[model samples]
Target: MYEMDGEEIFVIDGHVHLWDARQENIIHEGGEQFLQCFYDYHTGFTPEEEQWDIDTYRHYGADRMTEDLFGNATADMAIFQPTYLDDFYDEGFNTTEQNAELAEEYPERFVLNGSFDPRDGEEGLRYLEHLKEEYDIPGVKLYTAEWRDDSKGWRLDSDDAFEFLEKCADLGIENINAHKGPTIRPLNRDAFDVKDIDDAASSFPELNFIVNHVGLPRLDDFCWIAAQEPNVYGGLAVASAMTTNRPRKFGEIMGELLYWLGEDRVLFGSDYALWNPDWLVDQVMNAELTDEQRDEYGVELDVETMKKVMGENAAELYDIDIEAKKRQFRDDDITERFDLGTHYGGDAGAAAD
Candidate 1:
């Protein structure tokens, strides 16, 4: 098993989603219920009521589709489980199971993340244990889009959820990636930003808490969180607005993060299904950054850092030795797949080695 060379750096996208095109069983078995509730309660939201619908995920499928979309892609993708439109089961166990199946099948390309909603008490904890024992998932993902402030009965963080996170730390699971985005409430745009995650990191210093999407609209706040909490990490996942509206500016965000936390603390992630793989790769490759900026900011800031951001940090954090996994695939043919330069820049190639 050879280490990925600096030039041949293989990327690992920390966040992506999958739905088996063949698995109609998901919707019939509680998926629809979950979606219905999500739409009714979250997306189709009014001032008094929040609205959300499964229609959000109208387009998504398994790894095969992802692979096809990322033809000759530079980075490897680590797929995570997606959430439903509604909160059918607070524990994202079923989704985790499906993700595990994909990871086990495609160990070379896909890394598994276990998702567990803290709302389900003991059942949620058991699910985390199950993921460790049965699926070998290396990380956990939580979505607080609908989290309610228990005292006021409005949506926000929950004490119960925080307690569950404390337990996750006790379980030897060091990484917890949480999603914060433009989904539900607005005023707290910066309120539940990545900085809010400092609470979890503070309570459980042993745990590595990654604030996903750089807390959506709160870039500065995300940077502050990473700056304050040693254990806290920030991510750039399908941040379409930033990447799309201002690619260079997005690189600047990365630059600031590097200034505060160094290269390794920030990670590369594509909220995949929401954003196409090719478009995201292009954004990163084209984002404005000098060699010094790249070196300082780490992955996605430049070609080399891109590789690290794609996979290395995530692999390190999750303890996934993909080099070892690649060795297991052992391709004697040494076939060169596709030249990744035309789209990515330098002539990057993948060998079946």
Candidate 2:
């Protein structure tokens, strides 16, 4: 939890990953290129002192990941959104099983989400069902642009993709997180298209569709679509990275989002491993819209609004009861490990409070 203006904010990092992009894991050259691209993004936006070495970044083990988040007390909880690049890597990058290794150890501190490729067809459907049965995952992260054997990518609005969405609705997995970011090498431009979300969000009103990075580089298109679709949400991952050096851009983006999607629909994402929540959370929590933006958008970036984007909105989507989780975390394994009892009102009616 973070103390800001005398209020405790229970931060839920909506996007994070635990993956292996080591040389050994690299089967195809695309894996190497992909990992390099991530490093470029890290160094491109991150502060010099806060950055990590390439070796450390490639495989920063579970121990460090746990400490980087909750140990600093910047983020109260985190959600694992897996990215499986099977075609690129020998062992898929950040699969649910890899993240579950850490999540299972600290269930109170993490929300484990699974992944599915519509290209996998029936086998994919069974795997998704297995994820829900095995882990009871509340959501699934998707990589629509992921390269398959011969295909470059698939569409979310397609009949095959709808089958998985329908299965999720049937199995009670409500959150559909799609990777809608800038175009990258090996992955085609069609992969990051935000238009497909319009149909999918409309088709599955029961499920919530979160567009990661707010479909940046296509912000206007995303905002216009989100303006019409109530179920579509924005996850601030790549967008939040701008807080370091691109405040004006951040303010403008936030302004548009608030103007279009409103406060309740935006969620925070550290895009961890790309950026650590330890420092990134502090940057994001302190984000403010300029007066011009406030006037233009006709909205306020007040504490209550930040509270929702920082944690509460994600809590609503995941059905996480904040009060109950607070009591649980007061004496949970993380608290015991970090000695953060006092933070959660320990001994002063910790549970009651």
For lDDT, the strongest prediction is 2
Candidate 1: worst-modelled 10 consecutive residues by lDDT:
44-53
lDDT of 2: 0.90
lDDT of 2 by residue, 1-353 (tens): 89899999999999999989999999989888888999989998898899999999999989999999999788999999999888788888889999999999998889999988888889999999999999999999998777677777888899999999999999999999998895435343556679999999999999999999999877888999999999999999999999998988898998889899999999999999999999998888788888888888898878898999999999999999999988887888888888888778865435564
Instruction: Return the number of clashes found in candidate 1.
Output: 19
- Taking all chains together, each candidate's TM-score versus the true structure is 0.71, 0.97
Question: How displaced is residue 78 in candidate 2, in Å?
Answer: 0.6
For model 2, give the 10-residue run with minimal summed lDDT.
Answer: 182-191
lDDT of 2 at 266: 98
Candidate-wise lDDT, in order:
0.57, 0.90
Winning model by TM-score: 2
